[model samples]
Target: MASRMDRAQAVVAIGELFREHGYHGTSYGQITAATGLGKGSLYNHFPNGKEDMTRAVLAHVHGWFEDNVFGVLASKTDPMEAVDQMFVQVDDYFRSGRRLCLLGAFSLYDVRTAFDAEIVSYFSRWVETLAGCLKRGGLSAKESKVQAMACMVDIQGGLLMAHAFDDAAIFTSSLARSAKTLRAAMGDRVPA
Candidate 1:
């Protein structure tokens, strides 16, 4: 909030602000304070205002997961490795359950209606790619998808529980349970 920031920097700050305060809860005044940009300067970077900022944040998040998670899952020859990597990537990305998932946050409000397509695609793409990886590991397609969905559920729910309880171990245990489910399915050969 004290230094000059380009558009990308502004978007990252805006994203953290939005994550801390839901879409409806955040105001332009807060954004300006967060980014240290005046209305005129902010408008110059985002002509469409908040909508443009949200789009940029979503795109950044999408691209990161695409390269680091979904894409990794889609291309890895070793399905178990890919799945294990998925959990590691996710754990790091969320800062060990201390950070909120931007897409999940966005999906919790009326903002969901505005960015519904993006939100749906982010979650669905993750499941699909991971399911594909599991199927390659010899899980039946249906079972693979089920396991992927369970992981997703555990992740989202774990984040919520961690935030509510202020306990990262709860989140850790949730992920372990998810991984355990897959490990059980895979005959206990999943990598640690």
Candidate 2:
């Protein structure tokens, strides 16, 4: 159990590095330095080394989004309010767009084979949850799904822009627009 906990901590520590430098950019030396675990122990915990760590990081990211984002969306009874709360949660989670999204960041790397299916499922579940919320708020099924997809595109695009410009406003503004658009589908008047 102690080894399991140590491995979990190592995965989290490595995940933070991957979030900033991406999979290809992150190295075993860096992971060792970050976790203070020598090669022997590192390989002991992750027999497949970087590949294992990347998979663990992806799993960590997937679990976090499921708990922090989708869980909120699922539990809210008021859909528009749920949309509103989700944007707030997203804003906080991303640290106003300063924090890189591990899943989105992974897409830029050649290591997608390590966890592409999980990434797709994470994104699909996110959109499906949003679509369900929108449908609850009165949008037709097709419209709900379309708007959900748009929201996700805007979010990932916004994150890219935020990183490129070194500005949080880009992501925040896009999130606001996403929420407003979702609300508008419910015939709610969105403030300008």
Top-lDDT structure, candidate number: 1
**Alpha-carbon deviation at 18 in model 2, angstroms:** 1.0
lDDT of 2 by residue, 16-87 (tens): 899878887888777888888888998898999888888888888778878878887777788878888888
lDDT over C-alpha atoms for residue 114 of model 2: 69
Tens digits of lDDT, candidate 1, 1-192: 547688888888988888899887889999998888999998999899999889888988999999999999999987777778988998999888998898998898889998999999999999999888888877888998998998899999999889889998888888888887886787644333
Per-residue error for 121 in candidate 2, Å, reads 0.8
| Steric collisions counted per model | 0, 0
Query: Cα deviation of 85 in candidate 1 (Å)?
Result: 1.0
User: In candidate 2, which residue ranges exceed 4 Å CA deviation?
Assistant: 1-5, 188-192
lDDT of 2 at 100: 79
Worst 10 residues of 1 by lDDT: 183-192
